[model samples]
Target: MTTRTPAAAVAALTLGLLLSSCALLDGSTGGDPTDAPSAQASERQRPTPPFVRQGRMSIEGGNDVTFELTVTGLEHDGEYLMLEVTHNYLEDLPGSVTGRNPPVRLVDPVSGEVLRFLHDPQSGDEPYGTHFVPGDPAMPTHEGLPTTLRRYFPAPTQDVDYLTLTGAGIGLVPGIPLTRVDAFTPAPEPNAHEYIDPETFAQEPELPDEIWYPDNPPPPGLDTADRRQTMESFVDGPTASTTRAGDQETIALHADEMFAFDDSEPTADAAQTIRAGAQTLRSHIGPRVEEITIVGHTDGVGSDTHNQTLSQERAEAARALLERELDGEFTLTIEGRGSAEPLATEGGPDDEQARARNRRVEFTYQVSPGADGSADTDGLASARRHVAEPAHFFDELEPVTTLIHDDVDLHVYPMVRDGAYAFQMVGLQNSTLSPLEADLDVDASAVPGGPAQYTQGTLGGFRVQEPDTGLIRYVVRIRTGDGEYEDFADRINELATGEQYLALAVFPAPAPDVTEMTLYAGAFGQVDVPVR
Candidate 1:
């Protein structure tokens, strides 16, 4: 993201200030230095400071509107943190740049935790944050003007100094300085066409309705209690992967990797893979884990009856090996899902890969409390040391690669590690004379229905893989206000010709020593991308 003030606006404001100073110095009107009229005029004409971040959004009629955002204050006020920002528009816009409820979040760069806007339970669970004032009429667009808004969020730990602001159409703005203050202070309004010196800007009177303090408790609503982190890891060779959400972990072993053709007997490598999974369970099992469930699934290829029997036999085979390896430490149960539940749409664009993923046997269990929900190093190392099959997906092109398809050009950039997440930005350009919609959604028909569904025209399918371990990292899931999880990327609709747009994709941060990984885009194949 980049930031700057309009050059023309700055020049015009500077010239006006110069003339005002000359008139005062020459005593042309014999006005007082602090005259109210002169002071008011200067205040209204004062130019705004350079914005900290800027982004462009395509509105109706294929018109692109550029929006600038400036953070005036991010202060800690005992109970919660108060955020003040100014939104500036460079030109007239037809629609609201940010809807009534903007999907904005403050991401802690150190812990990789995301903080969302607080909600008020007393008021029908309405969001505690808003850009419009209560009594003022809703103004969708200011038309070459600026609007100042305030929001509240739970404060991070004291050791943190900066956070990244993401979502709401703007690209990721990293390195936002976090300031500590005794009390919350209102942000000064910004001028759309003028540059204002920070020292000269005057603070407005505090609003009478401002009531977010300890004396007046916030509305009863959800806080950080429901906060949880989800991480996923895919083994390179065996079509095996693990997804950890809080204390629960699910290990997925592809059926194709475990069975020979349509047979239920374990393949030569199936015993070793099952043993690796058992080792992982033994390492993380707690007193609460009395039973582990192993479920088998198949792709949409075979008849329902045949798939059901095959899935059942496969689940039993996996359970048999797992039980032997565990040595009676835990009870095992098995089930056959057949072709009922899938992780991807079977007949999607990437049908082969999608079907390969769908045909899998999953081991689900709960880990010990307080245990860091991450991949078990010993278990992963054991799998790599024992399993001998090659990686299922390989990178064909190197980082900073460009792929042109369907009249749209996509430039994939190198990935950057930010705390526990890997962030990458892809540039999109429309090559045709008219607007073009990018096919970005990964087939998420398997996703349960909800507002958090990633298949709703989003970059949910973008993923990264570690070349050495073949650990594939899917886009991180975000907890929506309704408590469902969704992909943490923006929903891209269309690309306008002659306009450059950025798409953001975030995944679980790979190991510190791993400097490069392969990115799997839906139709773009694989690119060997560098990680910094």
Candidate 2:
């Protein structure tokens, strides 16, 4: 994933001082020293909430760096919501390591809206988040040092009181209280090695002038306020996948079921499958939906020309059947992407399954307005709701379900619901005396493809399934402006001996009435766990 930094001028002036020890404090007492002190004392006397969340950053070439994060404030200043987070590294953060600051998002689990850092409209939509300081971007960090960073986002609804802070590598920190303040404040500095706890702070801190104010409305023509979250559903038999972002729906059909052995022609059963897809289109089509695109892809097996021609013919064949099945007059576009885009790793233990998944035809179209994004059941009968019977349902999530595979222990934790998403944490520990390449045999080919192909050593394969509805929720994906997708999970390459690394996977929230759902942990099989 590419890290989008803020504009050079703004980044250098504001974020460049991330490692500096100088504090930007406001000395103003607001006309009464006693008044300010009394306000501070009253705030300190209030019950202290859990404001600090701790996590470890596993640096690829360096030792694991433990860090504590404190959400100093998430204030809505009318125009925008400003988020202030303090990063306290327990060890020296090597300057050589870039992207020290992972991407952070404020998710309203109830609303299921994920708010990303606002981008500078003037700077070609570069996100106003992490950036490299002037000179040697890879500067070393000091131990027990507290660095504060601020990001702006579109404000959420007034009813939203708490939000979950999710960082790529830092995992999910839920239940952060949101405050509606008249003004934003700067982060308070920690005294020596001691950290400043915002929950117990007396008076509101002041923010630097540079970051407190930003251009309003984000300029004309730039669509920066779109806050729709994408919801995905994997049907039973794992036959098809549907992704809904806003009103647009993209349905991906498994080619193995549509065709047979290097054949461009649809098989006997293909008609039913195509009709199901056409039904899906007809059900979702709205007045705004003018055209639907059908694209075909093949696995990395045949030559470029052969695969390209075959993919094109297969797409055309599907189009022919879809035209007859549909009752509406809509423009249809067909294209073939030979072996360029693959949803799974071609040469791995699950090579055959990956290839079969790669051979697919996708239909992208716009659905009717006001359509429910979280609707589980779709048009296909075989792809409709069904029951998922797990092997076991643990009464207590503690004693965390540990699945041993190849001398490695993979621990699955309980699922907790936060607003519109469910958060699950899994730990991978190396039990062998020697360092081992952790291979839990997690395959994400069953899901749709994205920027990472959803298989680059990521926990994207882990999913949560509702037993009654048979609705499978894969890891949530954030769609970038370039029409690419990035998973909301951690990516691990290897594990050290006896080292237990924790990874988090975020999924779409199940029906409110459904409390117990089955967790499908790739090679570990399935287990029912209570959703808190």
Query: Considering summed lDDT, which 10 consecutive residues are worst modelled in model 2?
Result: 21-30
**Residue by residue across 1-532, what tens digits does model 2's lDDT show?**
1122222111232221232211111111112111225645633333223355455554444345556666676777665677766666676543323243335567766544667666674555554543332221221233464555666777764366666666544455555556778766644332311221222212123322222222222332434466434434333335566655545667878888888979988998889887777766666679667899999999999899999998999999988988888755788899999999876667766677778878888888876753433343446532322121111111123424787777778776666665456777676777987767656577523343322343333577777777775656667776654566667776554565666666667776565567788887767667777765
User: Residue 375 deviation, candidate 1, in Å?
Assistant: 8.5
- What is the lDDT of every predicted structure here? 0.56, 0.57
For residues 1-532, could you state the per-residue lDDT of candidate 1 as single tens digits?
Answer: 1122222121211101111100000001111112325544633433222225555645545556665666666776665766666665676655322231125677764454677655555544443444222222222333345555556777764356556666654445554555677666644342321322222322233222221211112433336544323323223333576665545667888778788877899999898888777777877779767999999988888899999998899999999998899999988999999888877676755777777777788899886744433456646441221111111111121237787666777777666555556677676667888887777535423222111223333567666667777665667666554556667765566666756566677766666567788877766666788765
Question: What is the Cα-based TM-score of model 1?
Answer: 0.66
Report clashes for each candidate as comma-separated counts: 6, 12
Quote each prediction's TM-score.
Answer: 0.66, 0.61
Per-residue error for 438 in candidate 2, Å, reads 5.7
Local lDDT at 115 for model 1: 72
